[model samples]
Target chain A: FATMAPSSSPVHLLFRQLFEKESSTYTYLLADLAHPDKPAVLVDPVDQTVDRDLNLVKQLGLKLIYAMNTHVHADHITGTGLIKKQMPNVRSLISRASCAKADIFVDPGEKIHVGNLLLEVRPTPGHTAGCVTYVTGEGEGQPYPRMAFTGDALLIRGCGRTDFQGGDAHELYKSVHTQIFSLPRETLLYPAHDYKGQTVTTVGEEILHNPRLSKDEESFNTIMENLGLAYPKMFDVAVPANMVCGIQDSHA
Target chain B: FATMAPSSSPVHLLFRQLFEKESSTYTYLLADLAHPDKPAVLVDPVDQTVDRDLNLVKQLGLKLIYAMNTHVHADHITGTGLIKKQMPNVRSLISRASCAKADIFVDPGEKIHVGNLLLEVRPTPGHTAGCVTYVTGEGEGQPYPRMAFTGDALLIRGCGRTDFQGGDAHELYKSVHTQIFSLPRETLLYPAHDYKGQTVTTVGEEILHNPRLSKDEESFNTIMENLGLAYPKMFDVAVPANMVCGIQDSHA
Candidate 1:
């Protein structure tokens, strides 16, 4: 029942999934572990945990070049602004479709590089007009099992509520099928929020088990429309703050 | 600033970290992805989350062979009994020193094999008399960055309280240094619980930043002794329940 792996490669990519409790948000710290310079990026960081994230960055001696957001969040403030203040060289990133201010606005098919790692930026809107999922892999060649940072576009056994902020059930459904489901079956999916404390999921599992996404288009739309979830408590405050990279208008 | 990873290995080991929010306990699910059988194991499962854990196991198409514990916990009950009740083939495992009822009594140097992945159990007592740390890697030659599942012997930037259940500060300190800290610098550490939302740490980071553990022996003991922590809310019920694999006298 036990055997040694015949072939293995040295781990060159550093991936750490950090959580923010107040918002149940996941902030990813990705770095090039093989490179001495240790270039890194933080995806979808929350405002409250900025200190912890930065401390981790410093402890690891990483040069964080980007604090990126998958989209404008309606749940909690982004840590991008706070991070930028502490580490001025760290640029803010967001999707161009987001209509939000950021240091760099990316579009579909753009490639984000952190040292030896590659994050293929693919547009996966519908939960919001601006949401994008970041997939890891060198686009054309090398069929490594990739990981997708699917913000709110897709969740574990569920999808995001498409009731507000330019929400559309049809768009969300189409986006997941075309962009996310098209990835390799073994691709690991990491979402921004998980209220149930689950950390990661695979594309294969989601296609088979995701309750909402697995349904027919009509049934999926019906399920989305009838979720009856209440208005998000932080929607008003978080959306405006996140618009300017999580710095409130008064402060900005 | 970006370069393709020179070499890479196909991922054959499946690792997922699940959480139970009530007590901040972490349950890990590990499997062999390269094997056709997909043999798997669950480490430190919680009682209330058994349904979710089993559901995940089913969804992943994994053959759960073992439900193991690092030690008998004082915070929350274990899901071993319930899981046994559901999956008759799955055996319950615990350290022999725990003096707890389990189908398999593992020792300090025992290797628990789940398909191709191997968990080399190493004694890491101090948080409790039976605490153990499971390190993953072939025992020799393979210099791969391993992972240590260090129950409460270590937490992110902190160590567990050594006040009860045969807890000892000195023993805990020596165990962490000799067993966990001795691993490769990049070896990732996953604890049984985390009060903060932090998920993983590395030996290098913990060595430099762990508050209590980074200190000399005397300072460490002083910090642990004067934590002034209140009695655990679920200690009385949980400890006894866990002594019999989380099934109470009435249930048994």
Candidate 2:
């Protein structure tokens, strides 16, 4: 027997697809094609994973409205420029405090509207100088953010190392304690990359149990001291790649 | 105000050096060369680290007697062949079960002499098909094996993933259960690679609490299944490099 089911109400879908590049870095595409305009946001997008994102957008009849980077990643190459090149109308947004060059320099408290979705830029500058988490919700006077794109600033069971450019453990401590951890406990924490196989977590969960960040000052100092040795494999390649918006010249 | 006179048993000389290549691998050399005939073993020796090994051997007036692989590595390239080329008198030994070719296939049951030092080979093939652990002591019948050079089988707090060639979880269980775990609790475990900032650990510590291996069969299976998603970046470059005993032609 064949079965057919119909929904009573239209689903306001908001979901993400993970794309792992190199071994450790993860990029994501968050789409909401329920609206006729079908605007989508690309977060921490990788250079090699652009085709998959493009194909998915075309298949779902979604318009790529925004391409954003949570931070200048040191693990894998970014694809912000490539997407902008392909979708000329799409806006390339990055934290204004970040040293990276982009089309739209978003301030910390500024809000951006993409179709029916609203994103508030929140600066989280521990992992990199201009790291930011994109808070997503429906635009309203009392909007409650349901999801946060936490780049490399925070992870599932751990946090990003603070040994690279503008990486300050003490600053990271402040970023987590005052900025991220202050958010709603149930807000889903979607990091750009997670090597432990965990796709998502919550800010409250991280505050209570993150092995690296949930520690006393002395213990945090010890962890940070030891963390000096954990260097990324793609630092040399990814830094240069992210600088030009993930552009690969003929030599590359 | 003068410092207490030093003991007559020499200065207990200790020398340490590191080899950094491709920004991913760190090859180390440690030796007590107070004695002219001091015998030394290369740890996690890479093909490019050969020149430093040769320099140390010459400067110390010591004989290069053993070249070792922690395991058939899947990350950085190996240096077994290059060392053999430079020091033909030195013996190239690894676990007989390792699929890679070696000049002298070592059986775990046998003990070999290197000047006044004794080295025992232990089969521990969890990371790859033919991995081995080299235990060092003063003599063949030494009461305790002091140092263990674990190739890729085990790390400080974590165990290698069993998803690559000859990487069977059952075999890893057997290898860890019988071969490595059976050693004295204090026996120092020195791994081939450590990205977590730890340089060494003890077998007793690992067997009792290694997050990856010290678990039930179901948990072990779950971890291994999850690890299958992210394969090593150097697997393609490393297999061919190791097959030819770590040699890399310019084209390669």
Candidate 3:
């Protein structure tokens, strides 16, 4: 009774979770099919899969209102710059704290509108300084409106590390608890990056089963700090490119 | 008497075949240990492995003289630029026909000397207009120098396609027969790239078993034209960057 999905059209909440193999990034395309224009929003577009994502949008005949990023990724170049170049009117959005130049600097508690749907921002930084989780459709009238685009802030059974650029374990814990875990227990969790092939989870599942962050804040800090991660191969290239919205650094 | 591979110093020919997983590329590192100063030459160092290669070079305490290429690749960025940046004295060498801006524009019959070893250029331009095989140790009074860096022109039981970038089937067939097959049957064939986990082959084995180019010229042309090859994904990004000697095309 809550789902606004029309009987005539099955694509009510038109959604696609696309994957780019190189960086293990998941790009989310959400469209409100109830509206005639089919206004859409894209999250975490990867530069390498620009054509792939654009083709999907074109095939769906959706007017892309915004191309958003959860954070300034250090693993792959973002497709925001390229998407804006392709779709002149599409606004590129990222957290104001990310320092990444985009068309719109989104802030915590801001709502990005696409047709009748709204994406609410919850600052869940820790993977990166500017990380945020985009929550949508949590009102009384939608059955499946509770979904979170949890950037690198939260993974299926894991959490983002606090070792790279501006990462802090304690802050991440607070952010996750107050911002993400505080959401409805059944809210679907969709992270920005996943390597283990597990795609979606829930806030309750993460709170109970997220091996890395389900522990105490101190333990989470210890684990995040001791990941012994090699600097990502694309770190040098991705960081600079992402700073300018995925444009490669010519000066480098 | 000719074989200077003494029992005391078994490092007569310091040889290592490295693999770059992203591009499925093979890099050959050859150093002549007979001389007091171990002069090293690297063929096809990939961009991602620059640090790894540099660390290896540092660990070995070897003086790198030349960073060469079999051809300008269309798969991965070359490490030539990074190598040059790290080792200012190292010369970057590729075929003059490649139009790649490098320190040395090597031509057919040119010998690149590294301590006591020499890399002789053999024009093998079937794979690409600028493709060339580097043959080392084909002269008298030299022991253990019968090896060929065949690039993509000749692979293990296969040959590169004559589909793009000035590729010519007839030229490739003739070049392989005269330049590569004319070498000693026992000559080791080290290709620039391989996919099936094949590390090395021999002139004798390839000449007899090379399914694509072993037949007559017409047969070779037929196979080359009908391979149904997809243009490499990195063609656009790699070609321009390789032309500038492996620098990433920041403008792209």
Put down candidate 1 lDDT per residue, B1-252, tens digits, no spaces.
Answer: 024221222236778899999999999999876566788999999988999999999988899999999999999999998898888899989999899988899998998877657789999989999999988865432225788999999999998889999899999999999999988888989999998788999999999999999999999999999999999999999999899986563356
- For B122-241, candidate 2 gives per-residue lDDT tens digits of 777766878877776543334243767776677766677788768887777788778778878767776665553234567766776588778877788788778746767878988877
Q: Where in model 3 is the C-alpha error above 4 Å?
A: A1-252, B1-11, B139-145, B247-252
Best by TM-score: 1
Cα-based lDDT at residue A90, candidate 3 = 92
DockQ for model 1? 0.66
Which consecutive 10 residues in model 3 chain B have the weakest lDDT in total? B1-10
Q: Please write out the lDDT profile of model 3 over residues B1-108, one tens digit for every residue.
A: 245543223335666666676787888888876767888988999988878677666656678998999898888889998898878899889999888888889999
Instruction: Considering the two chains of model 1, state its CAPRI-style docking category.
Output: medium
Ranking by DockQ: 1, 2, 3
Scanning candidate 1 chain A in windows of ten residues, the lowest lDDT window is: A1-10
Count of backbone clashes for each model? Answer: 0, 4, 1
Best-to-worst lDDT order = 1, 3, 2
